[model samples]
Target: MTLNAAPRGLYFDDFEIGQEIVTSARTITLTDIVNFACLSGDFNEVHTNFEYCKTTAAGEPIAHGPLVYAVAAGLQYATGVNDGTLLALLQIDGWKMLSSVKHGDTIRLHSRVLEKKESSKGDRGVVTFLRQIIKHDGTTAQEMTAKYLYRRRPKA
Candidate 1:
């Protein structure tokens, strides 16, 4: 992949099992939650009602878990790691929500390459990453293992 300055794109061969990639941070806003709710049809009270959440362990309205997952995936794309020939996004498995993500809470994502293997077809390779969504306080709120298929760079 052609590397750019801001997005931090990484090519197919640039990733290793333990390499960590950090993305630009974003804060979850009430508007964001409401918009997501409208789009996804998840209007759970805990996610949209402050009064209801006040009595819950979250203690406040929180962002949807799927929204947080989307942000983590967006981080990988925004950081330039998704450049070049991306054959497919294979899967995102083993997702876990470790903490509540509230409105106004800033979050960042970090992905560590967990495995890489050449495809039998030889045109692409599989890359699996351990993705973590962490709050500004460095607490992990979400985690997942995402896998993708990337076309190998043409031999010179």
Candidate 2:
């Protein structure tokens, strides 16, 4: 069996509380919505059926809540803050979808490290981050606090 080497990335000690990081923007598209619907089995009319959406309050198809959340999470990773140093996602707290994400809306994640603590064994640490998914127009589409466990750097 081949040994899996640890990926080089920021360790638990590298993070500073209150440090903010922004990610590259991505535009929501019909294909992305459709793909997310297929993958998640969430074929909601507001996200898939344009005709049905016309009769709704939004009057247009909106992206799925989970889709937006997933995208925001991906954007956070794209920022290279955690990278391969992430051990596991511990929890998600106070996740709120503040506004609808519609097709053609470019969005990005703005995240701040909220808290950090070492594990009992000191082999890893947990980091709590406050993340906001903001649209190009400056509207906050979603906000959440996510906790992740990151590995500590190995001692030489």
The candidate that achieves the highest TM-score relative to the unseen native structure: 2
Q: What is the C-alpha lDDT profile of model 2 across 31-113, one tens digit per residue?
A: 99999999999887888898999999888989999998888878877777777899999999998989999999999999889
Listed per model in order, the count of residue pairs whose N, CA or C atoms clash below 3 Å is 2, 0
Q: Which runs in model 1 stand beyond 4 Å of their true positions?
A: 1-9
Best lDDT goes to which candidate?
Answer: 2
The regions of model 2 sitting more than 4 angstroms off are 1-8
RMSD of each: 3.6, 2.2
lDDT of candidate 1 at residue 143, scale 0 to 100 = 88
Q: Candidates' TM-scores? A: 0.90, 0.91
Clashes of 1: 2
Write down the TM-score for model 1. Answer: 0.90
lDDT per residue, candidate 1, 90-144, as tens digits? 9989889998999888999988889999989886799998989999999999988
